[model samples]
Target: MAEPFHIGFLLFPNLTQLDFTGPLQVLARLPGAKLHLVAKTKGPVETDCGPFLLADTDFNDCPKLDMLCVPGGFGIDQAMQDADTIAFVKRQAEGARYVTSVCTGAFILGAAGLLKGKRATTHWAWHSHLARVGAEPVKARVVRDGNLFTGGGVTAGIDFALTITAEIAGESVARAIQLGIEYDPAPPFDSGAPDRAQPETLEICERRYAGRVADFEAALAAALG
Candidate 1:
């Protein structure tokens, strides 16, 4: 039998659940693919909403993956600051055939210095932060630079994964998966991106995440030292 294509996803406390799970659900359905939920340590990791998820494998035990996925959330601030986590991402990305991130997970990739001088995108709220991390931020739902794929916000993970499937498996497989999921997204709200959102709404989101920004800034400073 052919070797399975292994995909590793990083799990950290306070991570945005959709950022990883949405993509995982799609990718797991692919034939002959192995998925590994990797964490710095073995055990349960909590989401931002207080749900705990059990990881399938610890980082140390996992082999080099065909793809490495980093999901973004409030927890990413902590992960970015963690030397161990950053080092793990850096090492895995170096060997993985594909390196990818969802939403603020791009920040974690940036923290690992994988995005320097690269064109990328992240949650609209963090576009400036992406620039701060030495990446050229693009205004798009998904940005692909070489083998690195990045998506914007939580829901964008689905799009990124579908795109990856199209690239790796085939367009027919990606279309089948899309049709299986019935993924015809029609957001009730008009504001998904900053440019589409009202200035006031954008301000509110910025203010709401101000503390996280500060925390991430400090963490980046320490990590860069």
Candidate 2:
């Protein structure tokens, strides 16, 4: 029998749950897929939103994956500075068919030197930092540059998953999965982007995120070091 397509999502403390779960809802349905939730150690990892998730495998035990996914959230600052995590990503990406990330997770990939000269995207708040890590940032929901795929913000992971599914299993398979999940989105809000959001709304968001920017900048420098 053919080998199951082994896929792993790197798990860490304080990551955005939707960044990983949204994509998992789609990719888990791919034909022949075997999913692994990986971490530096085997145990529960907390999400930014307060839930704890178990890491099914640790770095030493994780087999070389067919696909490697990293999710981003408030904990991204710490992840970027984590030597073991960066080394694991670099090692897996060396053999994986695809190297992908969601939201600020691309920052982790960039830290591993996978985004050099590659076009990528991340949460709009952190898009400017991509260049600091040597990636050419594109402001898109999903940016695909060769085997590197990146999703912007939190919910874009769903869109990224379908795109990756199509790339791996063919469009028909992706379409079937989409229909199965009723993936059609008709969001009631039009203020998702900076260009569309009211000035006051943007200011409020900027204020909320202002305090974390310095921490991120420091982490990026450490990661790139």
lDDT of 2 at 160: 99
**Leading candidate by lDDT:** 2
Off by over 4 Å in 1: none
lDDT of each: 0.89, 0.94
User: What tens digits encode model 1's per-residue C-alpha lDDT throughout 87-145?
Assistant: 88988998888999999999899988899999999987677888767899998888999
Per-prediction TM-score to the true structure, in the order listed: 0.95, 0.98
Q: What digit string (tens of lDDT, one per residue) describes model 2 on residues 3-47?
A: 899999999999999999999999999999999999999999999
In model 1, which residue pairs have backbone atoms overlapping below 3 Å?
72-105
The deviation in Å at residue 78 for candidate 1 is 1.5
